[model samples]
Target: MGGLTTAAILSDLGRKVCVLEQHYTAGGFTHSYERAGYEWDVGVHYIGEVGAATRTRKMFDYLSNGQLEWAPMADEYDRFYVGDKVFNAVAGKDEFRNNLIRQFPNETQAIDLYMRLLDRTGDALSAFGMGRGMSKLQRFAMKPWTAWKLRGAFRRITYDVLSDLTDDQDLIATLCGQWGDMGMPPRRSPFMAHAMIARHYLYGGYYPVGGSWRMAETIIPKIQAAGGEVFTYAKVEKILVENGRVAGVEMKDGHRIRCDCIISSAGVDNTFSHLLPEDVAIKSGYRQRLTSVTPSMAHLGVYIGLKGTAEELGLPKTNFWIYPGNNYDKAVDAFMDNPDAPFPVVYISFPSAKDPDYENRHPGTATIEIVAPAPYERFEKWREETWGKRGDDYEALKEALGSRLMETLYDKLPHLRGKVDYYEVSTPLSTNWFGGYQRGELYGLEHSQQRLKQDWLRPKTTIPGLWLTGQDVLTAGVTGAMMAGLITTMSMVGARKMGPLLRRIYA
Candidate 1:
């Protein structure tokens, strides 16, 4: 997202830019993998807050030059199966809430309040969503409490918010079905976090045409046309610093590329702990906040390739938010401790179901991804000097989890039992080593309302000519990272031009 968004904005502003990626492919997790005939998305199971008529859609349209296409998910895009009851999530804004109220008739008021809060979260972004330059005065005013944010963090986002709204436990769990997106559980994650994600998709989530990679691919050409370049497998060994200021980047092959600024869509932990100097001087409360706050959750994803058509094999359109039993936190705990534990929280999605052409291209091919929150400690025992190395134990752990996922898939889709052609599991170890994220946390720092990394993770940093961006500044997922990219560009240019730029792009 950073690579694409940065290239677009910078190229538009007439600044020569080059995006470096470690993977042979771009888009990081957004890119899809093809094994035999199956294509699946490693990230972006579904994107919310991107209605066709909304500002996000307009932003996407201008960014991609209308080259991209979005497919609206069908009725009941997602289904939640807790215990014996299955809650169908239909598309259409009004339809979504009405169905929820129908399912939990007695808790109508609670459902209404939940939806309203979700809206508030989206509205709240207006305060921060614009590039920082738009509100330099506000940012300056709030700088002293950089360790803290929004003043009353818990009041804005806490268990108390939801608890006060609804007494219906099952209803609440259903409301939080997409918790994996936030990475942290409800108890630890803030209500503001939940509201931003939830409300964004309330009009219903969307699936990109082609695949998630198309999102990256479409923007690349736009960036190139705007005079930028994207180089792949070009690993940056370290950030070059001159007198505590960012000078450029030194690649693994010993080549150096100089630049005026740097923006890392890479996870925060990866940026600070790996790319930058290990003992670099800590300038402000920013580094302190990073040290003090806990990182977000990691994930274990099982990607399966099936030998049969999704319809014949019984696949659903929306994702399946499956919990073995309703002991949400306990189930997550068991799975984190014991990968072999029975009945863990599983989120299942089939990319081909979203784009049948993918299946048309690969007849009788279906792809499914089953993911669960995992702990960095499970494989932290192997975090030694071999930082970027892949190990034997790593593959073994992946296979164990993969087999379990296959079992779960077969149970859910019996016809697909023997029809599965291939499968693989991705763990935190793989994420940290390959993706360069520290401790395997998907999003950067956890947003707990308290200890927000307001100073450090933003565009401006303690060192001169140095800055930070990506998942840390705005949170994870495509939109959040893109917003970070916008800020990084704004920091270089004038902040006042941000709103006008949007108007220009649309014009």
Candidate 2:
């Protein structure tokens, strides 16, 4: 998304662009796959802020040239299964607040404060994002004012900030139940990130009409319309540098694409550690800088195909987030320390239920995706092995893990116990195989307080002509990456050059 969005904007400005995707398909995580007549979207389960004509929506409209459409999920878009208790995140700000108040009548004050903090995050995020792309002198000039406006929200820990509002741990867990969205638990995540995500989905959740791939499908044309092109399987093996500046990229197939300017949406780790020359990376301080941040949590995905339709299977449009208990941080720590311990979080999404055009795409079939965090270390032994050919040991482990996750689904929706026709498990290695994440991290870089504080994680790197964009540059999510692309374009072309483009996108 970040790459595609940036290409569209640059192309519109009459600058020819080319997007090289390492994956066989475009759209990165947004891509969907078909198996046995069933199709499922990988990363984009549900998106927020696109149901209406908000800034986020308008950007999507402009990028897809109004070809992209959204289908609203249930009013109760998110369903939480925390232990035995069930909670619903209803749509609409008032409805969400009222629902929460009803759930915790005694914590009205804390809930109100939480809502206020989410509102305040708007200013904090703007300041923080602006700081990322600004030059040293520009940032220094804006530092004091931005700090005063943000009020340290960007530095504080999410759990610490929320715990101050209430003693009830269950409420805190419920509020941060979507922690997996950012690939970090609240105890370690930045409060600003939490607020951004909370406010993003306050209205409701939306699914792209047709499928998530429609996003790239629609936007790619804009790039092509301006004489730019996106190429899949264009594996860039290294970023060529000469005289301490980017020269071009060397492909794995021994081909070279030489250009003075290079925009890498491949991700920070890959760009610095894998792609850039070892000496250049060290001399540029990126090698040392990487030590401060860690990869986000990797996950195990259980994709199930059912013989019946989503309606027949009674799959709700609302996403299901199941946790062992309200103490999310504790649960996550336990699972991280011991893999056998219950999953810290099990997020279930019925893509077939969310997308209105699913029936037309794959009639008489339903697909369910269950995602749970899994350490990359567990799959480390198979790191050198080929994907889909990792042998019996890998297959056994996957089946065992997939079966456990399947039980969770049957536990919630019992009627569909014997309805599953086929299922497959994707470990962290699968993420690496498909998405090129070295550690198979679902989110590029961790959203921990330390990672979020890194000022170097921006579009303009120290290396001239080598730019960065994607989840690592800003927050994580489809919209977040899209915005990162926007800021990256501004940083590259300057505000004066991008002013008209910005006005048109927002207009």
Against the reference, the lDDT scores of all candidates come to 0.72, 0.91
Q: Which sections of candidate 1 miss by over 4 Å? A: 131-136, 140-158, 279-287, 337-339, 381-393, 451-453
User: What TM-score does each of the candidates earn?
Assistant: 0.91, 0.99
Off by over 4 Å in 2: none
Candidate 1 Cα deviation (angstroms), residue 492: 2.4
lDDT of 2 by residue, 267-314 (tens): 899999999999999999999999999998999999899998999889
Q: Give Cα distance to truth, residue 359, candidate 1, Å.
A: 2.9
What's the lDDT for candidate 1? 0.72
Q: Which model scores highest in lDDT? A: 2
Q: What residue pairs clash in candidate 2, if any at all?
A: none
Compare the candidates by TM-score and give the number of the best one: 2
Return the lDDT, model 1, position 360.
Answer: 55
